[model samples]
Target: MFIRLPRKLFLFYVSVFYLIGIPVHAENNTAPTGSFKSKACMECHKKNNPLLIKDWRSSAHANTQPITDCVACHGKLHQAAASSSRRDSTCIRCHGGKKDPVVHSYTTSKHGVLMQLEKRSYDWNQPLADANYRAPGCSYCHMHKAGHNVSAGIRDDLMDKAAEKKVREQTRIACLDCHAPRYITRLFENGERMLEIGRKKVREARSLIEQSSVTFSDDELAPARAQLVKMQQHLTNVYLGVAHQSPDYQWWHGHPALDGDLLRIKGFIGELYRIKK
Candidate 1:
């Protein structure tokens, strides 16, 4: 008999070194709409990296990255009339173009999918998350904040040009930000969900063995099929965009269970399928 593992237990076997899961359940998905303070972030960042401004000059966020910085999305809304949810429709407005280079690739990403269908697909009502720091999106990752320590230093070691201390630190911080508590929590959660998918896939493949020893009937198999399909839905919803259509993720992370062999993935992506690709 093949080995069987439960979702929670199986996930432990496949998580990245730093990932860990946290359970969260919410029914309401109201958006946040508060104008948080941004003058502070702007004050120092403007002086630190002049070029940073250029990146946003013609970009969507620049036009409306929320002058309130992180708070704009995480906090609350209080203006001319009253409070309101931060509608994601605003984000989709300029980023909806499929052929537009800057946002085209991102829109097709899982994050894009989540953002687009957040209200309808899952519980999007802003929840406390029992999280100390509110989750930040495109803005927090790119913008600077008050008391924002800047260790940006010269990377002459790599880039011939001297690195702007502020810019470098912000970049480093961005990576570290992913490795933080929230990052680990998210990965572990994804892993746990994947483990269930992995189990369902195994069951599906076994059913195809067509051996005397094989046991499940069509009616009995219906549930597994449904589960696996749900997992694939998640595959498209969650993991498809991280590395783009890279061979490794499509294979190791996405394909194996979808098709019995990883080669199917490699063939689909072909060469030049690495992340850097």
Candidate 2:
């Protein structure tokens, strides 16, 4: 006769088998992505350095992008030797690049130059409150309230109606503290108009480039490609320069260069098409 196992024992064994199998499936499914450990940093800082934590919590860095943790700016070894002298470099890591027009514009702006000059004489360890800083840095305009939201007034979302309204409102509030309401409004309007013009020019240049690709040979396309790239760079520079409060860059380095590149591209397209005909 076959011995009957108790129902409880049978169910217990089945449950253990399923439990063991589930983890193998789950491990494959739940592999880690590169997510920041911001909560861990916050938890530790909140207890050990309450004031610093408070400032960071209220700033745009903590509020906006979750990935932008203490390690993002301060680095992994910040606890041992955190210094404000490295702030510009740390910020530039993300902001000041060839592709990043906004922060890159700041490096060529008057404020950026002044900040660089002041840093030569200023002490990194000195408290910001006590330090006689000459010009505004990235933190001065964007992080006025020790805010972490760098995108508060300087977002490139003016094309969207809802985003435009929100950005304009935020920009107004931010500008009013340092500038008159009329001046701020005028400046924003002018910048917006210039950006629209720049966009049209870039689109025209790109269209010409596309046309050239079909009409011209690989060797002939090199110059067109170079001009197109230069035009795009200038367009981006001008758009960001206006927002960053650098009229000289907007006019001299940005719009003028863009216009020249656009003209060159147009000439190239015309010559290529004429030769094809």
Candidate 3:
């Protein structure tokens, strides 16, 4: 049987601290270390936490299936996590296996690539020790049974509703997980849109660079180049932005193209007019 690697499911909380009016408490509210499969179980989840009741009573995941309880997907709710792992063998009991396309696609992507590499090379990893040999599994996002004091993490905070909506629209995965193909497609579309806008902005600035490049020798070129450099930097930062602190992206993603364009244009102007080849 094949399994897919875990994907990032992000939710945009318009409210940074929806729990600002609330408190952050750490209680051993992990229910009896058993399954959440009964009305009693569901009630218990909501009962202990007034806020859980309020938040989930209106959640689609609450009563996702009337016949099947939350345990059907989330696993034994109150169990002591049974080891911090991303095992999905149990999940495969319901949503994975050789026939699942998500399983297939994941096995093909980088996430899956890691698993295969690890499995083949890690003779010590001859078999998955727990259902969680996979890191970052389904439960990490959806059906998450974490927290105390009746909470819904970021959902509690409030932010710009429109921005939140845009985030969701742009991200069909809805923060939990998107079906396999859809996830890839959504990413491509997002990148395409960004690249499009970025290229357009680059073009707009290129004309200015061209004009400045021609009429200026090194003296005039210095200041004009500085201005162009600033504009280029601004566009690069805006379009290729990420939250991570990584140079892999800065040189490869953010700067290469911009720098290349500038050098090429500068060379062209100088040579075409013999300003300073």
Candidate 4:
């Protein structure tokens, strides 16, 4: 009787071979070759751990990609794999880098901060799409019925009025999963007000830059221009802080920082005026 090595185990050996400079000629140049059977995975896991199988069945992953499987995200060779497979990093297998803009913005938020602090105590076996975690992580909020659509409730470019409305509606629905309707509404209203204030600050800075630009050469106005760029970035941080419910980011890193940038630009413009006179 012959025993077949699991697909993940076989791939592990293949990698070792490559490291040792040994040649390999895989028939399909793929990990899931002819001998690998996803059914084999189900048969054993169903008997051993039916709850995990059930979670997978209910997930968008079940009906969708072939990549969303046992060995695909979780790999082989483990002490039953268990909750270890259900990490945020596992989502990154397909979702990509920690530095990804959406990922970065969220990580800097209160939700992400809480998740980072309390993740060790979380029930990793809980269904992420169902919002079963204590604090919402990437999968908890974004994993809709359609699968990992990270941009579902996100309004990165608020200038797109149509998109803003759509994303606002979606964001409301997502927030309602954990918060009161009144609270969500109030937060949205406050965020809009804050964003408007930030925008006004930016406009004031732009007018100053424009006034200086009219009299001075581009080279002369370069310092003010650079400060304007920094102010814009700080304005964006304010937007992120509002959206992400990060108070520290909203005040200290955002509005206050923007104010300082504006002051520097204003001082530069004043000096330019003195030089002109």
Candidate 5:
């Protein structure tokens, strides 16, 4: 017969081993990224708040980046306790809409919509891995594989064929845990086709912009360039839409929006030609 240790005892042994395995550095910003900072964090939190220390120790952030500690996210300056919204803001700092409207697109998705609608009723105390909420949030899918390793599920460079193929396989594996294999394959096929269509529309818009640039002065081509930006944004929306499984983004905000921008740029190109003539 196998006898299992209690969860607390298991954690205690793990923590003890962790303490022995890692070297502790003196508190200083000059040492390295997380070396000294993590040690400093562990020193205080390990005694006063061992549970938080345990969570961070087991996280990917700890192992991957040499323990991405408190200072990495919270900063060196201590302050009063923040609101509940702090965690969301911290996540958005890196994953937010700086380069793309990732958060915005998520808001338009079904998961996001449902999360917004039903988040209050959810047990906020439950760990993210439990998937206890009625609907998924940013953490649900992104952090599904590993809690602190949020980027585990996110594949960044979709343009590389090899990388894309890998992403497809990884996504299929993750989705299959909850969905049928056939359904996952169908969705992947559909999303790829939709993205291809969106890319073509963007290419057409770019071609029109290039044509306009030859004849029109910088001032005259401003509107076309502006429209191209809009087209690019729509293309991004399409990507976000497909990844998030949001039909509104894939259709209305993605494809049709790209179409509108393309046509407007074409109109500008025609206007420039007429002026040239």
Candidate 6:
């Protein structure tokens, strides 16, 4: 009942269990999906081009779950001589739309507008020291120093709230390179205030919707649902479009659209209430 097996015998038994596909450990640790352990990229790039490897290794991309290797961004058919001008599209593939709402907002921002007008292109491998480059691109703010940490120093309301202060401080330091500290601070504070007001309005609309759902038929409730969706889209536009530096969107598109949607929601609620009475 208390026999102590020899260490060699114990090791041999563990080997047998493992070889037979029986798990000895209780923990179900598995690698993330879309991840690979192959060092094929590093094996070649490390010696031929050391700096590239170093840059990637230092980036958040290397550390994040579902870890990305060169193949993730560059595609499986990547060649050393392949043109890097297409990286922006590749970035948008994962970061655009609902995947990252800020990126969606950026597409409609002034910078995006100018880029489209001028037919400008951004290549991450290229240096930005040229004076001809008038506006900041995605790489300018997020990928400075060719750093892979896309969210570095960004103050995203969608991200972790606990880190907001630290992120804001870091973002201020980044902004100080081009803007006055006072201006940057005011801009960020205003953005926060705008986001707060938008959130409150959305909450009020949602409350009205919930109350309407209790009495209104599906056909009657359809317009309310449509208005609520519009309200959320405008609120998101306000929050993210400001952060993306689109003044016109914040004032002309986002704010006005949100106000109209809120009114529509209120009108729908009043109509439903009158019907109920």
What does candidate 3 score on TM? 0.33
What lDDT score goes with residue 210 in model 6? Answer: 85
Off by over 4 Å in 2: 1-39, 44-67, 75-89, 97-104, 117-134, 154-163, 209-226
Q: How should the candidates be ordered by lDDT, best one leading?
A: 4, 2, 5, 6, 3, 1
> TM-score of each candidate?
0.26, 0.61, 0.33, 0.62, 0.63, 0.61
Clashing pairs in 3: 14-158, 14-159, 15-157, 15-158, 15-159, 18-156, 18-157, 86-132, 87-131, 87-132
Q: Give me the candidate number with maximum lDDT.
A: 4
Residue pairs with backbone atoms closer than 3 Å in model 1 (clashes): 28-125, 29-124, 29-125, 30-125, 33-76, 33-77, 34-76, 34-77, 152-165
What would the per-residue lDDT of candidate 5 be over residues 98-193, giving only the tens digit for each residue? 334687777777777787788777765555454455576665565553334444445554333345555576455545556788998999888888
Q: Which scores higher on lDDT, 4 or 6? A: 4
For model 4, the superposed segments whose C-alpha errors exceed 4 Å read 1-86, 90-110, 158-162
Name the better of 1 and 3 by TM-score: 3
Residue pairs with clashing backbones, model 2: 59-147, 59-148, 60-147, 60-148, 60-149, 61-148
Name the candidate, 2 or 4, with the larger TM-score value.
4
Q: Residues 1-277, candidate 6, lDDT per residue (tens digit)? A: 2355677788998888887653523234221234333376567568756876776776667877877777776555444322352334556766666336567566667766665555445443455334223455565556554444556565445323465566566556545666788899998888777767777778888888888788787788888888887886777677667678777667766888877888888987797789779
lDDT of each: 0.38, 0.67, 0.44, 0.70, 0.67, 0.65
Between candidates 1 and 4, which one is better according to lDDT?
Answer: 4
Q: Single out the weakest 10-residue window by summed lDDT for candidate 1.
A: 146-155
Deviating ranges (above 4 Å) for candidate 6: 1-39, 42-68, 72-90, 93-110, 113-133, 152-163, 213-222
**What is residue 185's positional error in candidate 5, in angstroms?**
1.7
RMSD of 1: 22.7
- List, residue by residue over 137-205, the lDDT tens digit for candidate 2: 666555544444565665553333345556677556545655688888888888778877887888888
Clashes of each: 9, 6, 10, 0, 0, 0
